[model samples]
Target: MTGAPRIALITGATQGLGLALAEGLAQRLAPDDTVYLTGRDLDRVNHAVESLPGGGARVRGELLDVADPHAAGRLAGRLAARHGGVDVVFGNAVMRVGPDDDPREIVTEYAEVNNFGTTRLLRAFAPLLRDGGRLVVVASSLGTLHYLAPILHDRFDGATSLDEVDAQVAAWRDAVADGSARGGPWPGFVNIPSKIGQVAAVRAFARERRGHDLAHGVLVAAVCPGMMNTPTSAEWWDVRGAPGPAEAAVPLLDLALGPVDPLHYGRLVRNGKVLPWSPYRDDSA
Candidate 1:
């Protein structure tokens, strides 16, 4: 926005990988360019903004809850008013309803944050994105089932609003709604269906938004930030432990702000490899 060549907004930029990303980006960006760091906690956001290493890129803080229905549009308007428009919008912030939360609750959480929070921002900000601009979604490897088995596409790909996600969940509401997403899970696998659904949503967004093709004309890619050390997954893996968010931010950074092509939209990519999450890997072992 503001006729600038580059301006970025990273949500959930306070702690964990998000903070690391803000730090990393600050090191590389110029002083003129700004990176708006947002988070639910105002203190954390302020800290993130103030903590930006004195350098080329400037830092700003905003308190936001991605799960809020009105937050996305408000942010979009803020960007429009403050900076004319935006060139880069990274939809990285997400909050899960947790393992203990019922399926309905989880669906609600996902719809609130991931589906609505991120998707709505993407849609509202679509106007601000420069013609050749980049949009990076810091999804998880959990968003893909290729590494596990038996992938499935969401029947809800056409949904673009909360009403739609609710309707879709209602459809499953009547069914036996197995969180496993299939008859059962493969050994060492958890939440397979939800992950697959995420990938499907990314693909669906691309298909519906970009001529019903794959990875076309836009630099859209959903990266599986493999098992990062974050609280989101603590419900199941706490005992086993996991890599810290700082550690997992490497690949994520690449997916978000690194150099890439514009036609790779809707590509469920990892590192440089295209993961196989379709055709439903039947190996249940």
Candidate 2:
């Protein structure tokens, strides 16, 4: 709190992957660096921040629920006002439609939080980010590819063509319209394509905003994080089912807080490297 430290703001830092990532940064940050841990539960977030590596990492706790009804923009604005500029902001909370929820309700709420919530968070902080500042989002590989379910949970990838996924979405709408939306999880194949579409939208959002000569360019990429055992999945961490579930956080941290390069902007990356997806830098791919 003395010297102006480098700042990183992370949502969903109360537990699981978010906590792990925060810990990693705490271990590495210099005295002047501050980590802003945000979440819906104040007590939980405070505990998480307190429990972090206390060596000298100046940890600050901020409470925010990105999925709260119409609150994301306001929340982001508050962060911008408080910090002046965030060196890194990681959007990582999640809301998914599942068998326990109405299918239509699920998609609507999920999109609101995952897509719209993420967009608003970034836009709110655009002014607060220094030139060359970074933004990282926690996305599932399911948000990119149609992988088989591990008998523990379900998810979708959003990297494929929107047309194909749109067909499924239309069908889901039809089913829900007739009051026949099935109770089972949406098929993996169907979900992956839809998720990819969402990711694509995020990328486009970055592109449109790039026209402005903002501080440090934005690297708005989502990651799979490989279904680790976290609250989002109800703490279901069967290695066979949620294999490498928390493994993606380290790479996610790197993508957000590590050095920036000209090649990785708006790219969907994992494992400390930007994937060749979306032709982010592959001109002829």
Q: Scored by CA lDDT, what does every candidate get?
A: 0.61, 0.60
| Angstrom error at residue 62, model 2 | 1.4
Tens-digit lDDT track of model 2 for 97-212: 54356555456555555655665665566557676677777765555332333331222233233343344444544554445545544442234534554555445555655555
Superposed model 2: Cα runs more than 4 Å off: 1-4, 96-105, 145-194, 211-218, 227-247, 276-285
Task: List where candidate 1 sits over 4 angstroms from the true fold.
Answer: 1-5, 96-107, 145-193, 209-217, 231-235, 238-243, 280-285
C-alpha positional error of residue 179 in candidate 1 after TM-score superposition, expressed in Å:
10
Judged by whole-model lDDT over C-alpha atoms, candidate 1 comes out at 0.61
The TM-score measured for candidate 2 stands at 0.72
**Deviation (Å) of 192 in candidate 1:** 4.2
Count steric clashes of candidate 2. Answer: 29
lDDT of 2 at 275: 53
User: Per-residue lDDT tens digits of candidate 1, residues 29-80?
Assistant: 6778877888888988887788767886788888778888788789889888
**Stretch of 10 with least lDDT, candidate 2:** 152-161
**Model 1 residue 118 lDDT score:** 59
